[model samples]
Target: MKNLLVSLADLPAFEEIIDVRTPLEFADDHIPGAINAPVLSNEERVIVGTLYKQDPFAATKLGAGLVAKNIGAHLASTFKDKPQNWRPLIYCWRGGKRSGSMATWLNLIGWKAWQLEGGYKAYRGQVLQLLETLPAASRFIVLAGHTGCGKTRLLHALAQNGAQTLDLEGLARHRGSVLGSFPATSQPSQKSFDSQLTRQLARFDPARPVFVEAESKRVGQIQLPASLMLAIRAADCILVQARFEDRIRFLCDDYASLFDYPANFKTRLSRLVETHGKVVLAHWNGLIDEGKKAELFAELISKHYDPAYKRSSQSNYLRLSDARPLLIDPSGDLNACARQLIVDFAA
Candidate 1:
C-alpha cells in the first residue's frame, strides 16, 4: 500500500477528504468538503470506549470487527463508483487507527490515499492559526445599517455579482438579534464556526475588497474570531439605508417564519423591558395578545430598534454619520443593490 502521511496544509490539493470519525464528531466540525466514513458510529464508539476500560485487548478485537464492517459498507456504497485512480485524504481524531485502516484499504485498492498526519485535532489547530493571520492583506468593506435594512441579503447579492462577500450571520446561522433565529436549526459549535470562517477567508484574494455585513461580537452562540473582528472594525465602512416603509416590509417578510411562535416573540420583547420601561412593555405585550403584529413591529422599529441602532452605530462605528448616501432598493432588487455596492465601495 502506498498511503503516505500528510498534514492539514496539503488538504486542499486532495480531491476528496474523508473524516473517519463518528457522525457526531463530523457534525461538530470536519474539513470543509470532507465526507464522513466513520469507522465507529456515535453509539458504537461509546460502546467500544466503555468496553476498553474493562479489557483493552477485548475492546481492540471488537473495534476491529466494527471498523471492518463500517469500512466495507463505505467501500460498497460511497466508493462503489470511485475509480481505481481516485485520490482521497482520510483522517480521524488524532490521526489514529481509524483513519489508518481506511487509508490502507484505499491504497490497497490501487488508489492514492493519504492519511492525515495528526488528523482532526491538528487540522483544527491549523484552522485556528489560519484565522489568526489570514484574509491576511485583504481590505474589508463593511455594510453597516439599522435593523431591517436587509444587510445579509445585500451581502448575498454582492456575492451573486461576483464581488467577494462574507455573510457572517449566515455562517453563524443567525441574524445577530434577539428576533433572529432559524427555528429548526441551532448554530454550530464555536470551533465549527471558526473552521467555516477559516475555509471561506482562505479562498478570498487579499488584494480585493471583501464585503461583510456589520455585526456585534456575538452572533447567537458563535462569537466572531478576534482577528476577523479586528479587521472588520478597522475596515472602510459604508452606510446601507432604506426607507422606513421598505424596511418594515422587508423585516416582516424576512422574519415571517418567526411570527409562528408568538410566545417566543413575546419573550424576546420582554427582554427590552428595562430599557423601554414597564408601561411600554405592557403595551407591546397587549399588542401581541390582540395580534397587532403590524403596529407592534412598526412601534418596535420606530421606538426601539432605530434609536438603539443609531446610538450603537454612531458610538461604535467610525463612519456611520459621515458615510455616503446609500438608499437600499426596498423592492428586493438585491442584484442591483449589490452592483451599486461594489461600485460605491470601489469608489
Candidate 2:
C-alpha cells in the first residue's frame, strides 16, 4: 500500500510525522504540529543547487546518493527503537523527491509512511485561499486613534480583558508608522504572515467581535490580506482620544531608542514631511534638528495626527473617549482596560 497525503484537519489521527524540508523553511512556516527532520540541511541544499546548475546529471546522481545515505542513517538512529506499529508522515517542498524517497524507504523497512500530496506548498495555498475569503466570514471592531494613543497597546489589553482581538502590526512586527521598523526585530515574509494569520484566526470565534487596530492596507513591508481589510472596514469603530501633550509623551517613550540615531530620525521625519507637506513639515523638522523631540511630537499631533482623527471620526459612528485621565493609566495596564471594556460592552 502506498502512503498518502492528509489534510491538517485530519492531523489529529496521525500519531507521528517527520518534515523533510530544510530547517530554515520549516522555521519560517509549517503545519502546527509537525516536527522537523530535514532530508537536506540548508548548506547541503545550496551545494546541490550549485551542482545542478553546473552539471545536472552529475548533480542528480550525487544528490540521490547523499539523500539515500542520510535517510538510512536517520532510520537507524531514530526509528530503530520504535515499535513496529510506528507510522510517520513525511513531506518536502512540493511532496517531490525528498519526501517520496523518505516515505519509500520507511515503507520498505516495514513502517507505514505517507507523503503530503502537494507538501508545504499545498498547505500554504490553503492559507492564502482562506485569507482571500475571511472578510466575508469575520466581523471586526476597529480601534482607531492618533499616533501614541496606544491603539496597539489597547488591542492587547482587550484580548486579556476577554474580548477577541487580532494584533496585525504585532504579527507584522511593525508599529504601522514611518519609524515602524525596529533594528532588533524582523518581519516575516508575506507567505509566513498569511500562515500566522490563518493560525491565529482558527482560534477565534467568528460570532464574537474581534478588536483590531485600524491600519492602512500596507503595514510596513507587508500588505494586509484583502479579505481582512474588508472585515476591518465593515466592523464598528472605536476612537481613542488623548491630549496632544500626552500623545507626544507617549510617542517619545514608545520610540525612545530611535532618537539615538539622529540621521535615521531625520529620515523618518522627512518621510512624514513628504506625506504631510513642506512648510508644516519644516516646523517639526526644525524641532528634531534642535533635539526638541517632545515639542516636535506635540506639533505633529496638533498639526497632522489630530486632523486625521477628526476626519475619520466624522466618517465612523463608534467613538470612545480615551482622552480622560486614566484613573490607573491604561498605558501600562492594558489588561485592566481590556477587561473593563469587555465587561462594559458585555453589559
Candidate 3:
C-alpha cells in the first residue's frame, strides 16, 4: 500500500488524474488536469459529516457503503472503457480513507492506480508555495494602461504572435475594475485562481519575458497572490497611450453587451457612488437612462477612471514614471501594435 503512493513531483507520469473529493471541494480547486470522480458527493458528504459528529463507527459504516456504491458506478460508467493496462492517479482531500478505498478497489480490479500521497490538500499547499515564489522568478513585463487602452486585446495579440503572456483578467474572469464584470459570468474562487495562475506560471520560461497586464491587487472578486502583485509592481512597465475618443469607441465595442443591458450596466456603475459621490452616480445613471453611452463613457474615463489610474500607477508601480510609452490607436491594427511591443521589449 505504501508503494502505491506517489508525490506531486510524479504528476506528469500519470496518464489520468482523478479527484475523489466532494464536488464542492473539487469546484473550489483541484489539480490542473485532475477530473472529479467523487466517492462522496456534495450533499452526501454533509450527511456523512453530520453523522460522524454523533457516531464515528456508524458514520464510517454509512460512508463505506456509499463509497463502495459510488466506486462501482464509476467502474461501470467512467472507467468502463479503460483497458486492463490503464493506469491512473487518484486523490481525495487528505489522501486518507477516500483515496485509499478507490486506489485499493482499482488495483484489485487489475487497473494499476496510484494515490496522491498528500491528496488535494497537499497539492494545494504546493500551489500556494509555487505562487509565492514563481512570480518573483519570472521576468515580467507589466502592460500598464488606463481603463480601455486595448491592453487585453494587445495581450491576446501578443500570445497569438508566440510571446509568453499572462492574462490575469482572463483567469479571474473579471476586468479588475468597477463595471468589469462579464454578463452572467462569475469569477473563480481564490483557490481556483491561484491554481490557474500556478499552472500558467509552470508553462512559462523564466528566462524569456512574460508580458502581463498591470492589474491591481484584486481582479473582480479574486485577490492576486501577494508575490505576483509585488512582482508586477517591481517589473518594467509599458504605458499604453490611446486617444480619449478611441478609448471611448474601444470600450463601447469591448463592452457592447453591457450597453444592451442598461439596467445591469447602471447597477454596476452604482458601485462607484462611494468613491465618486451620489451626484456623480446619479448623473452617470441619467446618461444610461438617456441613452448617451458615448458621453457617459467619456465622463467615466475622464472624471473617474483616468484620475484613479494616474494616482494608482504613480504610487503602486515602482517603474511607471520611467515606463516606455506605447501609443495605441484603438481604431487601428492591434496585432501590429502587439508585434511592435514584442520587438520593442525583445532585448
User: Which numbered prediction scores highest in TM-score against the true structure?
Assistant: 3
TM-score for predicted model 3 compared with the true structure: 0.96
Global Cα RMSD, each model:
2.7, 4.0, 1.5
- Note the residue pairs that clash in candidate 2: 161-339
- Expressed as tens digits, the lDDT of each residue in 1-347 for candidate 1 is 44699987687799899999999999999888889889899999999999999999999999999999999999899999998789899999999799999999888888889999999999888888898899555688888888887777778888999899888888899988878877788999888999888878888877678998888889988888778878887777778888888888878887776667778888887888889999998898888777766787789899988888877776666656676657788655779878877776663
Assess every candidate by TM-score.
0.88, 0.82, 0.96
Better of 1 and 3 by TM-score: 3
| Winning candidate number (lDDT) | 3
When sorted by lDDT, best at the front, the candidate numbers are 3, 1, 2
The sequence of per-residue lDDT tens digits that candidate 2 reaches over residues 1-347 is 46666765665677776788888988888876788877778988888989999999988888898888788878778667978788878888888899998998888888778777788888888898888876566667777767787776677778766788888888899987777886679898888788888878877777777778888788999988877876776666766656656677778888887767777777877876656788776776677668887887777777767777677654543333432233224345667667776665441
Candidate 3 lDDT tens digits, 319-344: 99899988787557878877877887
Runs off by more than 4 Å, candidate 1: 1-3, 108-111, 273-282, 329-337
- Residue 2, candidate 3: alpha-carbon lDDT: 48
Backbone clash total for model 3 is 0
Give the lDDT of residue 304 in candidate 2. Answer: 68
Question: Candidate 2 overall Cα lDDT vs. reference?
Answer: 0.76
When 1 and 3 are scored with lDDT, the better candidate is 3
